[model samples]
Target: MPEVKEFRLPDLGEGLTEAEIVRWLVEVGEVVAVDQPVVEVETAKAMVEVPCPYGGVVTARFGEEGTELPVGAPLLTVAVGAPAETAAEPASAESSGNVLVGYGTGAPAARRRRVRRPGVGVPPLSDGSADGSADRSAVGDPAAPDGPEAGGHRRSSLRGPGAAATGGEAGPVAVVSPLVRKLAREHGLDLRALSGSGRDGLILRADVERALRAAAAPPEAVPEPTSAVAPRVPAAERIPLRGVRGAVAEKLGRSRREIPDATCWVDADATELLAARRAMNAADGPKVSLLALLARICTAALARYPGLNATVDTEAREIVRLPGVHLGFAAQTERGLVVPVVRDAHLRSAAGLSEEIARLTEAARSGTLTPADLTGGTFTLNNYGVFGVDGSTPIINHPEAAMLGVGRIAPKPWVHQGELAVRHVVQLSFTFDHRVCDGGTAGGFLRYVADCVEQPAVLLRSL
Candidate 1:
């Protein structure tokens, strides 16, 4: 006998509301332990494995892979206190000690599996329990209504645009892909109205496209009967802005809407900086990166002009100047661009910054960067010049006061020592929130950065 308990999706933090099921670790009738990862889900921030709190036999799983569920939606039901052939001891209905953002332990109790008596209207839970009543939803039954087939439909429409796709006589609309769901929603197509051409009547992107094409065709106009082959109709590809790409889009949009931003540019001769970096790498135990040298210069400049290192508290009408520098560096990966923050960057040496930056960059590339690794930045240093571009007026990362953009350092003609010569020149662009400070502060910050780039010795003064 067992008492059934349902576990819902827990909040992964930072006000995220939903996540898509990337993988499922457990199945119905399988025994599980407390705090065991039951599913891997992808939120807007990162991928996380969610664990179940109850240790018991899995009775039901609510969602399939690729299904997006809201924060409070039921994920699965576990039958606790169940007596199995491999039972170690008598079980009681109790929860694990660990708690997530929106999940908690329940009261301890014990109950038997429900049994319908003689002339009873309800069905029994399992045939093995007490009086040998047959369970309608058996684990081995392929025709069970609460099995995988029905569960996919229930999870698909939980918080999606296809809410109408659930529960009908012909069975639930077989939609598994989120893109197909999105396509149907965009064209105002009812998924329940069409039969999917896929295996087990699963709705795919092609089926949604076919629906769109059929609906868009003119009622009166017909194709002419001609020997010439018809031209192929090109369909537009739509990518959903939901994960890291979506977060970037939303943040950038908000920054443009709220911040009165200004960009100032100056070209600097980086011959000396390059020479110093080469010399450091030649003599140092661990080689320092060019980006690290630039970051070192940035921290020094920020120390001189603290006004640019602050964010505006709009409601309080006060500028919040941060005491220590938590520097964020922009790194572009296969998934999308992410800014990994280096905590207490102002205190790190050039070699130390290089090491941390390398570690974070590798993490970003492998998509292992945590939410903590990606946030809490007092300032950002964007070295976009690695893309071989000279300069760009990049949109500021929202809430942060300013960003320092460094362009590619290349040999160019410049006036040096009262004579024209080829020198390593780089363009430095600074974008700052006007709400934080006037042009004087912004100009001072950029000027100091350019000075350090021109003369590496200028940084040693602050060091």
Candidate 2:
């Protein structure tokens, strides 16, 4: 046998399980050398090219474009020792440097891990990290360790199945079966929390719920194992997070959890800005909203106060300032909130802004926005005023320094000439991450935005 090496999915990034196959760079029997760009895979982050680790004859491709594959699964087959493995020119190393995802420095799976299902190497439902617990010898290979016949996973360590599989002092294993893990994941249940009541504590879906119910209940209930059902809201409809709603939930959750927010509000008269929008629409051109006009003002103000137009890295203690202003237009989809970026908002005219907003809104509603469109936004603008909201605090998108919320542009009584007069007044709210800016800085930014909306001609000075 000509030394055939199995090139399983290499670790792409830290803690990533699977990636969508993007494209294949080379064809079978094309005589590829080592470290050549073999396939392109798309993760949540980006499309990175995976390079061939061993040099040889092309054997087989494991997947097709758009097919997502789990890490450690065979991607392709290449027979080493042809003019291939050693045939490459020694001086040309740049050709191999392009290989991107997987094959990194993270440690492989834990030692003596337990198994729950087949080929899927999901760890056994366990809360505590894989440390001291369970029989260390129930199976063999720590990485795989999927229990054979335990659904399809190969059994690695052999704690005599005492863990959940057999149920003894042994805790949970990291490896889980495919079907069980999939079910658990779909239900938003953490497998680790489950105390399997199966044969030896082998976790089941029922077990997952039981564990959840137990955790959700107070500690007093464990001793009195009576027939008292826990009073909880059963899901009207259990939903598996996927598609646009899933993406939105994930992004918003990250924004809410990771970003600290402080808000500053100011009153802005959008009378002139509204007029500008109407003029642009009356020109029999692309229709625009006050949002488009506000975006223009924000683009200008960001130039003045570059700090608010930047991103704050809470851990790294760094602020990334983007040069161009790509305003994120918040669209309320039936699914959830999706903010599509209007790239280089400063360069586009009012008509262009209007058109792009229309295009993005249509795409968001239709679920056609691409993944690339979702990332790389420097700042965001949310207009709640369309819904009659008069200034509300909005969470800042993670990493972004600030986000602006526009309230209802309704008539409000104000003192005009020493007497109260009705004016088309609006409230402006700005939420910024204090890690990057102070209250004074955020307040100054809102004031600037307010000024731009009230006197639209002031913005013309910059133009």
Candidate 3:
């Protein structure tokens, strides 16, 4: 027998006790080297890749993809050399940590996963075993559990987990998030006939009640303790928490906590900026968004006032500056918020910046944005202006010295040609880490950005 080693899930970061397994880079039977990326997991912030801690032949992956696993659980078993005693054989029940108290191997939540699914927006099942498969809940008959019917009654179903959704009579059903499950007993819900729209068809309490309301009312006046049908138990599986989400929560929290900031704002005439956009949109391969223009302006401004683009090392008592600009554009996703970086924005043109920003947005919407897109942002732009807001102070996306919030462009009274007139005005709010950039520096950078936007022709010449 080969010498087998179990890869127990490590404390990814933060105080998170569990994570979801996103994907496995290395499959069973493949030879893996130490430190090679073997799997990807998500905790809360983003998906993180977990490298193999040991080198050997991959024996078994404890959980299925997209499952959440608790911390300190075994994720994979590897068979080392020699007689191959390491991992070819299965672990004993005791060593396997198999029990009802916590999560385990059937679900491979190796790490926190930030990766979101695009088309099917099913949030992960808490147990981590959502590979298009439904399982029996502890709350009911594993197979053919009768669900709550109308007026707090139960309905029966002979069909099993993989069976098709039936028509004609609406069976037991409900709708709700997982947090509502605790109220099941109080509300008197039956889980069996519950056709859940949840991640893996797990019966949510709302589904329980909806199913109950849709079914025929019981003839008997008295309410029963439970549903009508309860079949024999089916095979159940365990889900393991991978540590992916743990790492993300740690990173986001660290950023929010350690970074200190100060902010300044200015209203500028955006007629030129708007004109520039229209002209660019009329002729470009990829039309530039107001976001790309804002990025270009900020990168140029950072060139002079690098303080606004610096990174603060609060723990190390150090501040670092960069030569090029990497602007993280915040991409809102259903799972959560994500920011994908646009590398070296200064090097790219208005059109190039637009193309890159468009690409990242598409990837984010499609849930295909890579980890590289999510990190290393030297500065950030929150285009609240696009939402038609006049102006508001925006929080700094930590480490980076400052973040700019662009407010709406609307006709407002302003001095143009030494006369008060109505002009398209845009509000720019710049929040900087005061430790690195004083108010003057922040004000100066905002001024520079305004200059570029006000005289877009100069932006072309300056480039």
Candidate 4:
């Protein structure tokens, strides 16, 4: 007989505690290889494929699709040590080490043991058997009561249907997912009052949603005719804020609540800057982007005024100035807006910065950026000009001291030297934390950036 091994969900990095099952790659009784991706899960950070460490026939799966599970919950069970013809190597050799962030498979897992509660007994599977078979009751079906031969434990509801008629006592609630409990609590719905339609009477998210809809339904009553006709009202739609959108919301909200910020804007003549970019790209081995040129200007400004390149330590009541610059640029994709950082950006030249910015942008658009790529940003550059806007007051990314916003550069009427002429002009907006610097420092930084935009030669002095 093969030994059964239970595989629990491992901790995804970046302080994520849970993930929702998007899809399952393998089914029950299917053979899986060592370190093979068994399921696809979506965390608050990104979509990840979780690989199983042990290689054998999958015996049981715990959750269905769209089910949210916390860390250390049982994901599946695998039966190892199959017949020699089925497996090429022994089960002991098939075990892997360091598969994910937290757990590993160097030794065989302990056998499954049941722990009895004070006044409740462990219920068997829906089929009243101990064999590891696929449970179909998870698909909105009520489970049958356990027989005497199985466990002799009767499935009792707390306040479900027919409680007043039988006058039965309340039992343990059949709920395991935290998401279901949260949904019920938010809507002021009592989980004990409704009957579950899941495996072994386990309550699911769908049950709570159904109860809410029932409560919100209007009562059937005849209405009297009015003098004027009533207008039809459209139904409102609700969307759950989860994944990338949810993360962005929480961070932006915290920034608004904590940071006392101020914004300053300057309009600069960018005709010379555009011409300089054209000249640089004309003879460069790698084409330099306009954004990269702006980034180069930003690095030069930070060198002159290091006060803007720092974060406030609230606990220590100190402003810690960072030595190196990890520049972050905002990129909007189909998923949402994401900031990808360029490590040691101050050391990179125009060509190097262009290369790194291109790589990170591609990764962001394809939804392949890791948590590390999205964090540890010392400063941020937001180019909202891509949306064809003239100007915007940018919100500072949380914990970062400052952000630079660039608007679209277009032809405008301006007094060039001694004559009124049509020139390419752009708007630059800078938002900074009031705690880091005063108005004079923020104004100096913005003026330096505007000068670079007006005359590219000013940037050459810093270079």
Point to the candidate with the largest TM-score: 4
How many pairs of residues in model 2 come into backbone collision?
A: 37
Give the alpha carbon lDDT tens digit for every residue of 239-344 in model 2.
Answer: 6454345556777789888777788898866676777667777886567766777887888888889877787666787887778888887888644677788888
How many clashes would you count in candidate 3? 67
Tens digits of lDDT, candidate 4, 143-165: 22233321344543222432333
Give per-candidate clash totals.
0, 37, 67, 0
lDDT for each of the candidates? Answer: 0.74, 0.62, 0.61, 0.74
User: If the candidates were sorted by their TM-score against the true structure, best first, what order would they fall in?
Assistant: 4, 1, 3, 2
1-463: candidate 1 lDDT, tens digit per residue: 4677888899778778998776565555545666666666767776676778887766667665556889999887777766443333333356775657332225322322221122112223332335443322211112223323432332222122233455432323466654455456646677767777776566678878888888878679677767877867869866677777788999999999988999999999999999998999889499999999989998999999988889888899999999999999999986688999999999999999999999999988876677778888989999999999999999998899999999999999999999999999999999999988889899999999999999999887987
Task: Give the local distance difference test score of model 4.
Answer: 0.74
> In candidate 2, how many Å is residue 351 off?
2.3
Please, what is the TM-score per model? 0.70, 0.52, 0.58, 0.71
lDDT, residue 462, model 4 = 77
Of 2 and 4, the candidate ahead on TM-score is: 4
Q: What is the lDDT of residue 371 in candidate 2?
A: 49
Instruction: Report the lDDT tens digits of candidate 3 across residue range 266-285.
Output: 88899978887888789847
